[model samples]
Each structure stands twice: as structure tokens, then as C-alpha cells.
Target: MQQGGNPNDIFIKINALLEEAKPRFSEECCIYKVPNNIRKLNEDAYTPQVVSIGPFHHANQNLQKMEDQKRLYCRQFIERSETKNLESLVSCVQEMEEEVRSCYSDDIKLSKEEHVMLILVDSCFILEFLLRFYFLVTRGDDSILLPEQLLVHIRNDLLLVENQVPFFVLDKLYYLSFPSTLNGEDLHNHPPLLSLTCYILPGFMISEDNFVLLSVSSDVDFGRIAHFVDLTRKLLLKSSKLFQLSTSDCSREAQVTHIYSASELNELGVKFEVNKNTECLLDITLSGHTLRIPFIRVHDWTELVLRNLLAFEQCHCIHESYLTDYTLFLDFLINTDKDVDLLIKKGIIENWLGDSNAVAKMFNGLAANTVTPDFNVQYSNIFKDLNAFCAHPWNKKVATLKRDYCNTPWKTVASIAAIFLLILTIIQTIFSILQVVH
Candidate 1:
């Protein structure tokens, strides 16, 4: 095996298998749940459920307000399902949402936005779980259709929702949005106990950094979310400005480009200049297509991209790992030099990338097992592709700039260490001079 080559190769093979496996599975094979609090089914083997908060509310206002008014709702969806098919999982939840809505009196006066938001919040957990499952199956695959399929799934599901709802009301709900409040904890660290649930569409984004991560499909698109999480970490590590600019610019152009589904409507990708004129272009590769969106700033596009994402937190998930891994991937890619070249040349650097230490601590909180080396192997393959892309002279220059100038605050902390040491020595000399004079 050539350094990271074995793992890379293994990941590629596994990814290929996952692609074949996904469509074969059905929603009937998956089951999910939603609850007000963390529920434990087993005492010995406990799984900390991944939960999310959005702008809408279905049940339990106290828990909702305690987090953030802007948090649409705490979405707890399917983190793990016996069925691997994300489409199947989404289908089940959509059925459940329709059932619940139909059970209510037809006379119950509910606005279209209110009804959809309610459905979205209820299904939130399921969407989360489905997305997680997709992540688990396709983690190492790097399959292009992963994100594309996810987008199509979201579009189809939304069409179903539209089919079920009164068209006039659905139209009003589509445009209705509220201002987001940034009050909340980093629940990414603290895993909650919850059941498989899915949220109705509560569309919004983290407007600042433009790291858009919303599930527009009741069926979660694991590939796109993972990519988004990775992209976000890069932005957060880079100057928040660069992250915002790159993503926003790409998003604006993306809107003008192709959008086969709502998920594609929120395509996320990395964009950089290939020439001296800094001819900016959008790489929507992560969006699951090879088409390059030209004539837009990657930065400005992220805002629109992320904004579209926020418009649909309609997907589902159950495991914190799904979201956390996505976050960790982002952090690792952004904070460390673990891109295509570094991984290809040096292979995997265990415990060097991302906030692995912090993630480890977080895992401890869940009493979870350490991530296996096998998992690392898969990620190494992703770096292989990245390395190939970066091997280009222009990409090399951009990567270098990202490494030195665009990293997060923690990476920059090393620069201050020497300054601190210099200050300490100066203070000691001053003390020595004062004592001798006295």
C-alpha cells in the first residue's frame, strides 16, 4: 500500500458499493421517532440522539425558547434506520406528516405557512436520521449523484407536500419568513436523547458565514449536508468574510444556473481563480454536478446559497454524529492542511486535523466508542481527489493562501505564543533591573 493509497482505494470501492446499495433499499425498511426529550430505549447501550432547533414550533415551547427564538424548532429525526434508502425513509415520514395533518379538523384555521412549518418541525427528527444514514453509507464514496440524488429527492418530496396542501396557502407559506435570532448553545457538543423525527420546512440560514445547511427534502440528502458541513468549517477557519463571500457568490450564480431540485437550489461548492486576472468561478462539484458556474464571486454566492438552505430545514436526522462528523470534516478541511496534496503525499495524519480533541471530549459526553481507523481510511480517499485538484499550479497557490491566511482563530493562536514569551522575558528583565537599583 502506498501510504494513504490503500485506505483511499478502499473508500472508493466502498463508495461505489454504497451507490449501488442506496436505491435498492426502501423506506418500509426504516423506522423513526420524535420526542420532547431524550428517551432511552436501552439502559446498557444508549445512543445520544442528534437534535436541531429551527424557527417553527410544534410542541414544548419552553425547550424551544430556552434555545433560540430563531431556532425554528428542535428537530429530532431518524439518525439510524434499518432501511438504508433515504427516499424510503423520507416517504414514511411524509406519510406520517400527512396522516397527522389530516387527523386535524378540516375547519381548523391554519395558515399554509403555519401548517407546513408544523409538519416540518414534526418531521425534523426523521429527516436528521435519514441524512445521517445517507452519510454513513456514502461517507467514503464521493459519488457525484450523492448530492444530486438528495436534491432530486427534496424536490420530489416538496412536490408531494405541495400536492397535499392547498396551492394558494402553500404559495403564501413559501415566501413567509421571520428574522432569525442568534441565541443558542452549541448543541453539537451536547448530544440530546430524542426519537426519530422530521421537521416541516422552516427555511433559514446562518446568514453571516453563509455556510448553508438545511434539509429541504423530508428525505435528507446526506451527501450535500456533509459537503456543506465541510465547507462551513473551511469558511469559519478562513476569514469569516472569505467563507461568506465565496459561498454567497457561488449561490447567486447557482440560482442562475441549474436547479433540478430544491436541494440543488442550495448547491454548495468551493470557488477559486485559475488565472492571474483572478477570473472568479464557482465549483459546484460538491453540488453533485461538474458544471462550473462562471462570472460570479464565490463569496457572494455563498450567502444566497446558504439563504436558500435556511429556507428549507425540512430534512431529517437522528444521530449527532451525522451533523458532528459533517462539522468535524469542515473544521478539519478548513483549519488543517489535509487537502488533496497533503493527504496524497503524507497520507492520513491521525489527530492532527480539526478539533479532534474537542470532538473526542464531546464523544465522551455521549459515552460513544472511539471512531475506528477504518473511518479514517475513507476520508483519506477524499483527500486523494482534493490533492489531485490542488496539484494544479493555480490550486496550489490558492491552497497555500488558505493555509497561511485563511485559517481559523485556533490555528492563528500559534503566532501569539511567541509574542507572549517575548513579553514574559521583558517583564523578567524589568524586575531584575528594579531589584538591583533598589
Candidate 2:
């Protein structure tokens, strides 16, 4: 059989073709490993080629595969391109290159021609993985990504600032030698790294008592701040789901905890941003797990919060009370206007007025009784470490009752029944004594 001709030799054929293409674009070509199940794999593999070869290689094996699978539905474009439309694509590439230069500083800039080339290169390099991952993870159904064209356009952009070597080159060189922020903590020398790291282990307040230390460093940025809010929302949702799952199989507590840990990693996108710090550490007392995020560099605040909202909807522990409160808090944070009436009118925020009112009445009765309640005891132990909440004397009382109320509802019921029975027996005995005397 010819080297790559057999039906069973698909991978081999692709590899052979790559070997042949390597010398043609020797400086740019690099071998890559990609997922077969994800459709973006082929496009991703071919993106680099676009930068070097122009649009002429549209028939390259990967693009052909995409067309064959009807993923892109580009038969008409291919047919038209074969005859009439080369200049439009070139013009599109030119326009895309101009758009990229806007991202960089304007003071010490190159001429327009040089500018477009460098920006295209930078765009291609930075966006290769990001665009592919987006398509693979978010919207891979009816495929509309033009991976090869995008790569060429981005490559042209990068080449616009031709004098400046590609960023990844410098990033690789200085990254390892740079001072260690945390043994495994440093994300990037760039601005976004610090913020990205924050999302990996965003801090959270547990129950009404514990404050889990999600990270050690505290120089957080907007990205991390956004991530923290998003993570809190997702965790609460997950916690609610765990609660429901617990009602069915109490034995699944460990499983529930594991699911929380795993979901936290998967939903947070920290693994992609900060892969080194994603591992979980044991929390023996709580029978739970913890992951630490080091916040050093940060940006992209709004993105983080929006991401959190999406994750919150996916979490299982979402409770009605918590969701209602969370929704209000998120609205308060994101809404620009300071009008409470407007917020209520928009129907975006549900008033917690009713719950707060009930709580006030219960506390008022406690205050009137003038009784001193216990000052130490944790209900769920989840929030026990949160010194901010737990240090208050009033909080201690609430914590104590909450624990008792949650842990032994059946026992409390049984005690009330016993007391009623004893009272009834005494009344009967008194009646019998009266009869005997008569």
C-alpha cells in the first residue's frame, strides 16, 4: 500500500501531508496535538498555515474535511472564489489588520502597511487557542468558524509591527526566570495574569461562620473581583444542589463534596488560565475540599462577573432564598442607576423585605424574653472559620440555635411529646384522688 493511501490510514495521511508542507513553510509550521471529538481541532491545526500561505490553501485537507462534513457550508464561497472573489478576501484581511493596531499604544507606531502586518501576527498568535476553545466549548453545533482565514488575518495583524518580534517569544523567555510570586502562583508577565489567577481560587464566605481562604496573595484586580462574585454565585447554586442530592442519599456526602470540588474547577476556567493551582487540598474537619488562588495581576472585571452568573445557573446547590438574595446583590452591583424604585420596577431585583421583616420579629421576641443564649456552637461548620461573622456575641447565639435546630429536629419533637404525656398523667391521677375522697 502507498504510505498514506489506505482507508485505515487517515491519521497517517494527515501526518504525511504535514511533513510535505513543513518544508514549504519551514519557519512557521509546528506540530500540534488536538482533540478528535471537537470539530475545531482540524481548523485549529490549520490556522498557523494561513498566516504564511495566503488564502490559496483553502483546499488543504482540514478545510476540505470541514466542507465535507457540511460544518461550514462554504461550497458556494469555494465555487465563487475559484472564479471571481480573490480581491474581497484580500481587502477583508487588510481591514482586519487595521482593527488590531487599535489595541496597542499610538505614540511610537509604525507606518500603516507595517502596522497591519504586525497586528495580524499578534492577533493570530493570541487568538488561535482562544477562538478554537470558544468554538469547541461554547458553540460547536452548526459550525461557522473560518479558522484558516482567521489565522491569516490575525497573522497579518501581528506582522503590522514587524520590527517588534512576536510577544510569545519574549513571554516564554522571561516567564520562567521571573521571580516566583507563589511557588506555583505566577500566571503571566502581562496585565491580565493576576486577574486570571484570582478566578482560580476566588474567596468565599461559608455558611454564616466560616471564611475559606481561597488564596494567599491579595493584590486583586477587576478580573478577580468579577471572578470572585461569579464563583460565589456558582458555589451557592452547587451547594443547593448538594443539599437536594443529600436528601436522597445521605451516604453521598463525600460524592457531593467531590462534585463541588470538580464543578468548581470546571466552571471557573481557572484551569485554562492558571492550570498549576487547580489541584484541591483536603479539609478534614468539614469533610470538604479547598483550592487556593493567588491574586497578583488583574483586569477584565465585567467578563469575570458575567462568567460567574453563567456558572451560578449551572450549580446544583442553588436555593430559592440564596438565589433571590444573590440576584438582588448582582443587580445592585451591575446596575448603573442608584434608584431602588427603578430596580424594583425593572423586576430585576426581588425585595428581601419580607424575609428581613420576619427575622426582625423573631429577634424582637428574643430580646423581650431577656434570656441569655449559648455563645458558642457551629451549625454547619461551613462558616465557623469566618471570624467576621462568628466573633459577634449575637452571632454566637444564632449559630448555636441554628446548629441545634438543624441537627436534631426529630429529637426536639420527641421531647415535646414526652412533656405533654407527663402533664396528662398527672391530671388523671388528681381526678381519681378526688373521686376516692367523695
Candidate 3:
């Protein structure tokens, strides 16, 4: 019996362990912990700074200071909600606890009561925050977002892949909070949550001219959206006919072998121009010798937003990583500050960070830990065409000649003078030969 180790006891222990080891992932799972390989490059970009929304960062002591704020928002949300009582909201979340748990990639360790409470408070906070933001923008009302720095931090935190609740949770809470809006009386005053979300994240719009705030319709299915990150991705790709049409044909096994930098392309007679035809930043196009790219603003929080989006695509999107592909394309075109400067001068990039080197570094660092599966279809044709154009003997010779003799006005004049002198000397020699023959 060796230390009273019984067969039945061992069997029971093994059975319990097996139960715990069952798969936690579901088809609904979208919210993910940013992979360490990606997060290690810049932890602050992926980690929530002032607030934690979901289960992944719920236990972080650094984020606990925001707990009071969360409760306060939740209270305000309830006070203004149509239900006007806490119990209804609590019940709604409690009913969806299992489904909500399935939405997260990691197994939530909180007990049912704790999990429900977490979801309730976080969801209400987000809903209320968006509502206030909407009123502030549309009616000039003051809001907690009045503090510019805090607003920036909150925007960054809310967009982080790790710091998100399911969008459906927010949607359900939103409708429940404003039941009368469904009947159309207060519909104008209370826009859908998605529209308010767009207002708060204006940077993702790329161009205001083409960014349409989502309206609730049969075409707009809120159920499919996993979280704010997914919504942002959708918003980005919504207007890109190129992406919409080509995504299905894109091959995941292909890779982009090579492409020249912006300066290199310029040297090869390739012109870069600001694309005015489309608002989607991903709708980059190449025609003849010109490359047209939509304008993108780079600011303090740009990297933070992009890194999170990149991480989300890496973790979830299997077939179409549009954002990832776009990022890799930019990385291929920008290798140094010179490339950034070239793009800035061409109006492709609005560098608000004010440092070209920093912008270059940001683009270069974006694709460090990510994989571009559909790179071949996404921009492989452009690379192929550019390489073919650049490789032509005539093109290279012309480029070389320009570099050697015509790069400056003084050099151009000197070369022209030398050529004229050579022609004159050749004519003189021919005349001298004729004289000798005579």
C-alpha cells in the first residue's frame, strides 16, 4: 500500500485533471492575450495603461485604480438607462455569462458571480463613456473625456486587443439601456453604439470624406462583430473595393520576396502620389510608373493602435489579414528616415510625431513579429512590376547617367559643355584627315 496510495484515489485525481484540461476555445473566441513574442517588442502598446476591460488584465494591480471609475460610470449608466435599476442589467449579464466566457480565448478564472459583475461594470462603463462622448461632440456637452491626456489614454486602452469585452455584450447592454430607441422615438438622439465608437476613434477613419458612420440595418450585422478591434478592422476595410474584391483570390501560402524602398523606387523613375480617389488607406494602387497611396496620419498613439490591430490579426484572422498585409507593404517600402521623408514629401504620410526617423522606426518595427501570408496577392504584383521596371538595362543606365551627370544644374551644364567640346574635337580631326589626304 506504499504510503497509503489507493487506486481509487488516483483514478479520481486523474479524472478531475482531465476535466480541467478540456478545450477552452470556441468558434466565438476573439479576444486574445497578445502573444509574448509580439508584446515583448513594446509591452506598453499591447497592455492597458489606465483601464482593464476584460478578464485577461482584470487582476493587474496597476489597473485597479480605475475600478472606482468603472463603478462610477456603471452607476451613471444605470441612472440614465431605461431600465433604471441595477437588477435588470445584472440579470442580463448573468444570463449571458457562459456565452460571454466562450468569446474569450483564455479560460476566465473568475467565479460566475465575479465574472458577471466584471462584465456588467466594464460594459456599462464603455457604453456610458461612448454616450457621453457622443453628446460632447454633437451637443457640446462636457464629459469625463474633457481631460485631453486622459481621453488619449482611454482611447488607446479601449482599442487594445487584450482590453476588450465582446461587442455583442456592449450591444445588448446598449439596447437594454435604451429600449425606447428601438421604437424610433429617441433614435435620432441616441445613435447606435457603433457610431458613437467611430466618433471616439477618429484616427482609424483615415479620411473623413469616405468614413460613413454605421447605421443599424439588415446589412449591418452587429452579431458578427467580436469586439472593438474587429469593428475597427471592418471600418478600415469597408470602403476598399480592391481589398473586398481581391481577398477571396488571395493565397495564404505566398510571400513577397523583394521590393524597393521609396527612395529606390523614386530613383528608378517611379512616381509617388497621394491617392484622392479613395478614402480607405489600404486601397493603394499602382498604375504605369506612378504609385498612389492614401494619406495616413502618424501621431503619438498611432503605433499603439497599429500594434494592437496587428496583434489581433496575428492571433485570430486566418484567411484575410488585410491590416497585416498593409503594414508589411509599408514596411517593405520604408527602411530608413529617407523613406519616411520621401513619403512625407509626396503627401502619403502626415507625420505628426515630427520625427521622420521615429516614423520609419515605427513602420519597420510593425512587421517584426508578424507574418504576412497573403503578401503575394496583396502586393506581389506591384513588387514584380517595379522590379521588372527597375531591372531593365535602359532604365538602370538612364538612372545611372542621371545620378552621374544630371543630379545638379552645375553638373548638367558641365556635362553638356564636355560633350560639345568632344564633338568639336572629332570634327576637327576629320577635317585634318581630309587635309592630309589632299
Best by TM-score: 3
Model 2 regions lying over 4 Å from their true place: 1-86, 93-100, 103-111, 118-402, 413-417, 420-438
Superposed model 1: Cα runs more than 4 Å off: 1-172, 176-360, 366-438
On lDDT, the leading prediction is 3
> Which whole-number lDDT from 0 to 100 does residue 248 have in model 3?
72
Encode model 1's per-residue lDDT on 1-438: one tens digit a residue: 655658888999999998876332233211112111221322211111112222112233433432331122222222232223435434443545443344322222555555545444434433333344334334443222256554333322221211122222211111121101112232242111111112212112122212222222122322222222222223232322212322432121111111121111112223321222211121112322222222222121222232222111112222111222222333333322223222223222223224434323322233122131112222233334444444557755755654674466765576467668899999999999999999
Pairs in steric clash, model 3:
none
Per-prediction count of colliding residue pairs?
80, 41, 0
Residue 340 in model 1: shift from native, Å? 25
Q: Which lDDT tens digits does candidate 3 get at residues 179-252? A: 88756668677876767776656464534434443343224568888888887777676667576633575455
Local accuracy by lDDT, each model: 0.30, 0.31, 0.82
The lowest-lDDT stretch of 10 consecutive residues in candidate 3 is: 209-218
Write the residue-wise lDDT of candidate 2 on 86-190 in tens digits.
Answer: 344334446654433332222224667655443333323233223233334333543334454553333332221111222332222222223252344433322
Q: Residue 58's C-alpha lDDT in candidate 1?
A: 28
